[model samples]
Target: MTTITQTAPLGDRTVRRIGFGAMQLAGPGVFGPPEDPDAARAVLRRAVELGVDHIDTAQVYGPDVVNELIAEALHPYPDGLVLATKVGGARDERGEWVRASRPEQLRATVEQDLRTLRTERIGLVNLRRQVGGPEPDAVPLAEQLGALTDMRDEGKLGLIGLSTVSAGIVEAALEITPIAEVQNAYGIANRTDEPVVDLCREHGIAYVPYYPLGSAFTGGPRALAADPAIASVAAGHGVSASQIALAWLLAHYDRMLLIPGTSSVAHLEENLAVDGIGLDDEDMAALDRVAHLGAPSF
Candidate 1:
C-alpha cells in the first residue's frame, strides 16, 4: 500500500531502503572496541561498497566507542551518505544503559556525537526514550524535544527522529516539530509497534525497524526466521531465513527502511541481497502469522 520504491526519504536525502545499523560494530555488549578493529573498519567499507548509504548509530553504543570507529572508518564520508544517530541515553561504568534525556544531557550527547562522528551536522538525530519504567528519566519529553529543536535551529542537525516511543508520544511530538524518521523494536516476530509504524507512514515519516530479523543477531529472541513458516519460505526460495524475514518487511510496508547490521562480510552480503527475493501472497501470509506467536522482546 506504500508508493515507496527501491529508495526512501530519510533526513535530507532518499537513500537505499536496505541500510546498515552500527551497533554490532562495537565490542560484545556494545560496551567497548570490537575484537578486530581492522575487520570492523572493513565491514563499514564493505557496507558502503554494497550500496548502503544510510547508517543508524548512537552515542550510547559502546559509550562513544562505536562512533569513534565510524569516524575512523568513514570520515570524509562519501557524497550522499546519511549518518543518523541517537541521543537520550548514556552508558555507565558497568556498561548498563541509563537515561540521559534531561535537556542539558541531551544537548551534551549531541555535542559528543558531533565531535565523535567528525561531522558538523548529523543527517538525523533520534531521541531514544524508554517508554517503560527503567529509563524515561523523570523529564517531560517536550522539554527534551525542545533542546533538540534548539540544535536544529542552530544547524547542528538536519532532522529529528524518535525511537522506542509510543504512537501517543509521536502524536504529541508532531505538535512541536516534524519527525523525520522512527527506529522501533519491531520485526516479523514482534509487530508491537504497528500503530507507530502506520502513523509514520500516514505522515510520510520513515519508520526504521531495528530488529528486522529478530534479536538473533543482537541476542534478544529466537531468530524470526526460525519460525517454521518463515523457514519453509526461505527453504523454498533457496535463500536464508533472514532473507525471508527482511523481504516480508519490505513487501508489507512502503516506507519501512531496514538497518540490518552485521560484523561479518558474508552476513552483510546476505542482508544486502534481500531485495532480490520475491514473496507471493502465500509467502506473505505465512510470515504474518509469526507476529502473534509469543515473540520475545529486548
Candidate 2:
C-alpha cells in the first residue's frame, strides 16, 4: 500500500491529513445515544489501527455520545494522535439541533468535551455557528473567540477552529485568535465553500471538509454511488466509487483534511484506502469536468 504523506501545522501541532469523523458512532438519530456501544468502540480502535491520527467529534453528536465512546475506546491515547471535538450546538427535547454559541454555553461544552475525551486539553475545538440563524448577529464574533482564547490560556484547548463560517467570519476570527483550521462542506458535488477553502489555503489554515462525500441533502447514497464519472474512474482503478470521490478531494487541495464518517468497518477501510488511489493530471481534469453534475445547493 502506498503511504500518503500529507501534514499540516495546527498553530504548532502537526497532524496527519486523513482524519476520522466520529459522528456515525451515534445511533440512528444522531441526537440519541449510540445503538451499539461495542460497535462504536471497535470503530474507534480500528481507526487508530488504520493510522488515522486525527479524530473529529462534536459534543452535540449524541450531545455527548461520540466523545464518551472515544474516551472508552482510546483513553491514554497513542502519542501523536490529535483528538478534535466541536462545541456550539445542542439537542432539544425532540432531538432537534439547537445552536448555543453564548460564552457560558461554550465554556460548559468545552469542559464537558475535555472530560468526556479524557484529556486535559482538547487538541482542537471547532465553534460551529448555525447558518441562517438569528444568533450569529447577536453574539459578537470577538466575544465568542475571546472565550475560546481564555480557555486556551487556562490549558483547556490547544487550537481553535470555526465551522460553517463564511470568509467574513473567518477574517473576524483571525483578528482575535490564530484560526488553526476551518471545517465546512466542500466536495466534488458541493462547492458552496469554495471561496472559504481558498481563503484557508491562502492563510495557511487547514480546511477540514465535513462532508467530502455527499450529505443527506445532496442526494445521499444513490446519487453518489450512481455517479457515472465516479463509477468509470473507480472501475479504471479497481476501487469503489466512494474511494474515487475521496481521492478527488484529497488531490484537490493541499491542506485539505478529510473526516469521512462510517459505522461499518468495511466502509471505513474503503474510505481510508482513498489515500492509496492515485489520480494523475489527466484523471483529475476528467473528474473535474463531470464534478458539477447535479451539484448540491448550499
Worst lDDT run of 10 residues, candidate 1, spans 289-298
Model 1: residues with Cα > 4 Å off, grouped in runs: 1-4, 131-137, 216-222, 291-298
What are the lDDT scores of the predictions, listed in order?
0.84, 0.81
> lDDT at 69 for candidate 1?
89
Residues 36-148 of candidate 1 have per-residue lDDT tens digits of 98999999999998899999999988888888988999899999889999988888899877778889998999999999999999889999887324444478879989999
Candidate 1 structure, TM-score to reference = 0.94
What residue runs in model 2 are displaced by over 4 Å at the alpha carbon? Answer: 1-4, 131-137, 216-221, 291-298
